[model samples]
Target: MNRISIIIPMLNEADHIDNLLTHLLENSSKENIADIIIVDGGSTDGSLDIVSKYKSISFFSSPKGRAKQMNLGAKYATGNILYFLHADSFPPKNFDTLIITEVKKGHEAGCFIMKFNSNHWWLKLAGQLTRLSWQACRGGDQSQFITTSLFNNIGRFNEDFTIYEDNDLIARLYDRKQFVVIQKWLTTSARCYYTNGVWKLQYYYWRIHLKKWMGADAKELNRYYKKYVC
Candidate 1:
């Protein structure tokens, strides 16, 4: 049996963490779960208190960056596979079995197809695109699963990336042809879209992609995100 470590990087995610934990615990088998590691990026919103209430979770504080926090969680993970999940994304039932089956078949890394929790046409369209194997559709919100050996080989998430870290890692996996899109759909929060306005958030996301394509470094991407999204 392959052990699985679910690593969640959080910052002021108190509202969603408990629900996410409950869902995960209910859906996953205790025998397959190596540990649940929550690496908080200095959350002051009672996130720590909620995490403390869950005996199955192991928590740590890292600098305020998702890439940094996730890498920190990976460093302490003892599982054969490391599952990087966002607090607001919920994977399908039997996700553990699905991942282990794929690994047993020799797949090194993969992510679930995802649906944003929105009924808007564009969001639905965007969710549909994730079902395809295109690298452009990949994102951390979909939740990534990779063998620990493969993760170590890739050097883990790039700490320099304050944004686009998921794309960066996916890009590398694509280059090696080690990526797969599992058929199951993971549901992710569309709170950003609702909070930032649907079209406005979509436009900025495309702009950031274009900036990265035009050789914008991590700092440049971070600046764009802070100005537009944060």
Candidate 2:
């Protein structure tokens, strides 16, 4: 049987972790989910305690970057597939079945179409764009699923990226024509938009994309994120 290990790389997500876990446990079957691994990046909040309450979950800690945390989780996974999810993102019902069906149909890796949990017109427009297979629309919040074999073959996410890591992976996959965009919708938090202001956030995002296109290195991207994002 093809089994999936869901890896969620988290940091100070105590408020969202429990609800996400409950939803996953309720919607996914034991036969499909081989393991649920929560990789924490040393959250100072009560996130660790909340994760510990879920006896079925496996937990691990990493230094601080999301790429590092997810890589650590992947190292411990025993499933045939790895589903990298965000704590504030909710995949549609039967998501595991959807992914397995796609993989069985020969897709090496893919991500769900996604919407921001906001009613802003701009955000809605951005969400609609994700339904397209355009590489520019990809983001970490959409959640990624890859066969373990393909993941190993392609080499995992680039740990050097402190930001724009998802785009980097998607870019590589696009180059090899190994990426797909599932039609299912994933609802992801708009907390960043809300915190940073929608228009301003969108502008910075475009700037980052432009910078990457202009050959900005990972360190430069990280500096931009530290200065403007968080």
Candidate 3:
């Protein structure tokens, strides 16, 4: 049986981690999940305490950065497949089975299409676009799953990235034609878009993509994200 290890990297996400984990547990079969690893980046919001209370979760601390935290979690994962999920995102029911089925079909890595909790026109359009295999539509919030062997072969996510680490890994997977966009949809929080004005945030996001395409390094992209998006 192919079991999956779910790894979530979080920081100050007390608002959603508990509920998300509970949802995952409720939706997934215990037999399909080998482990749930919650990698905290020095959260001050009692997130670690909540994670510790969970029966089957393994919690650990890492330096504050999603890339570093996820990489650390992967190091300790024991399952044949690693599923990197966001604290605020929820995958569809039977997601583990879906992923295992894909792996069985020979896909080495992939992510589900993304949907935002909100029903705004633009958000809906964005969600619809994720159905395409185009790389521009992919994001960390969509949630990623990869065979452990392929993950090791790709050297995992680059810890140097403060952001866009998912895209970086996706790019390599695309380069090798080892990635797919599953037909299922994952609903992710639109909190960031809500916090920052929708149009304003969207524009800046496009700008960041442009900058990255223009050869901006991780630090440069991080700087832009902190200044405009965060």
Candidate 3 structure quality by residue, lDDT tens digits, 100-213: 999999998999998999989999999999999998998999999999999999999998888899999999999999988899989999999989988988999899889999
Residue clash pairs of candidate 1: none
* Better model by lDDT: candidate 1 vs candidate 2: 1
Off by over 4 Å in 1: none
Give per-residue lDDT, candidate 3, residue 177.
Answer: 91
Between 2 and 3, whose TM-score is larger? 2
> Residues 120-173, candidate 2, lDDT per residue (tens digit)?
999999999998888888999999998888888888989999988878887888
Instruction: Name the runs in model 3 displaced over 4 angstroms.
Output: none
Least well predicted 10-residue stretch by lDDT in candidate 2: 164-173
**lDDT (10s digit) by residue, model 1, range 62-132:** 99999999999999999999999999999999899999999999998999999998899999999999999
Total clashing pairs for each candidate:
0, 0, 0
Write the candidate numbers in order of decreasing TM-score. 2, 1, 3
In candidate 3, list every pair of residues with a backbone clash: none
lDDT of each: 0.93, 0.92, 0.93
Estimated TM-score for each candidate: 0.98, 0.98, 0.98
Q: Cα miss at 32, model 3 (Å)? A: 1.3
